[model samples]
Target: MTINLTMALVLAVLYAVGFYLLMQRSLMRILLGIVILGHGSNLLLQTAGGPPARAPMLTSARPEEMADPLPQAMALTAIVITFALTTFLLALAYRSWTLLGHDEVRDDVEDRRIQRLERRLAESEEDAAEELEKEATQ
Candidate 1:
């Protein structure tokens, strides 16, 4: 089937913006990102079905002329999934706001501690290797 350039460009933009927002620290941006991405996915599914024509009824149209219903069904399913995930994200944002007074995600203290420990270990390993090399040279 033929592809629509305009639809393709729109999908690309939606996905690009979605991913950019998803990478942000703000919960609201992430929520918006999910929404945009969901719309992009739905659009992609519809586009894959080719140009809309006759219904998928054999009585109404021949097999070649009838539109495929699979893509529409899949798009509907995607919509439901997206809605559920967005609602969960919304709840999480709300809870976060209630607890922290802000919806921005912060780095965990424990994660930083582990990272510092790993860095120290790596430095010690490098020092040990340097000492070994010095001894071999001497």
Candidate 2:
């Protein structure tokens, strides 16, 4: 289905902001991002169904005039999924606050170690290449 320019722009903005928020370290910001993304998704699904028409259950209208029920059902499913995930994130944020007194996410020690190892390996490779170049020059 075709969407108006305004609606398309709004969807783009919602997705962009949502992704930006998701990249933040704050748990609350991430939760908000998820909600915004969910909204964008629902809007996209609804747009795919074309314009709204008479209810599918009502037989008073022709089949072509009846609204497609799939999009509505999918939107409802998305809402429930979003709600469940939001609740889960809220609980995690609450638990994190109780333990750390802050909602910021921290890097894990294992990840740091892996980064250091990768850095060292890259440095070593660079050094080896430089040594080979020097030998060739000599």
Candidate 3:
């Protein structure tokens, strides 16, 4: 109904989608989620100023009808910061994909550790077998 309420609902939906995407394994999806979250936050900031009662910034604007400029400034700053952060994160994701052959970071730390331990155990067993063979020969 009201502009503020409408914006709040839109922001809530966007945030929900962003959170869902953030939980995904794909780097691209996560980055997109971050972007969506940023936009939602910016919209929320703009909405906080209460629907722009009058023209934003002008000398002839009445004191009682003046819209808050602080939110606009904040939105602009947030946009720039989000843009830079998005670029950096996307580049990191690309590099990670290239180096690791996948976008998702390995989630199974225990499995990787167990595999390493197995490799070490196998190597030790081979060494023991070789030593036994040498002793028999002697």
**TM-score of every candidate relative to the true structure:** 0.91, 0.86, 0.69
* Candidate 2, 1-138: lDDT as tens digits: 568998899999999999999999999999999999999999988888889799886658888899999999999999999999999999999999999999999999999999999999999999999999999999
- Candidate 3 has what TM-score? 0.69
Candidate 3 local lDDT, 31-82, one digit each (tens): 9988998999898888886765787567878777888888899999989988
- RMSD in angstroms, all models? 1.4, 2.1, 10.6
Model 3, total clashes: 0
Minimum summed lDDT over a 10-residue window in model 1 is located at: 51-60
Runs with alpha carbons beyond 4 Å of true place in candidate 3: 1-3, 55-59, 108-138
For residues 16-37, what per-residue lDDT tens digits would candidate 1 score against the true structure?
Answer: 9999999999999999999999
Best by TM-score: 1
Query: What is the model-wide C-alpha lDDT for candidate 2?
Result: 0.95
Clashes by residue pair, model 1: none
Global lDDT scores for all candidate models: 0.96, 0.95, 0.86
Question: What TM-score does candidate 1 reach?
Answer: 0.91
Q: What is the lDDT of residue 128 in candidate 2?
A: 100
Q: Estimate the lDDT of model 1.
A: 0.96
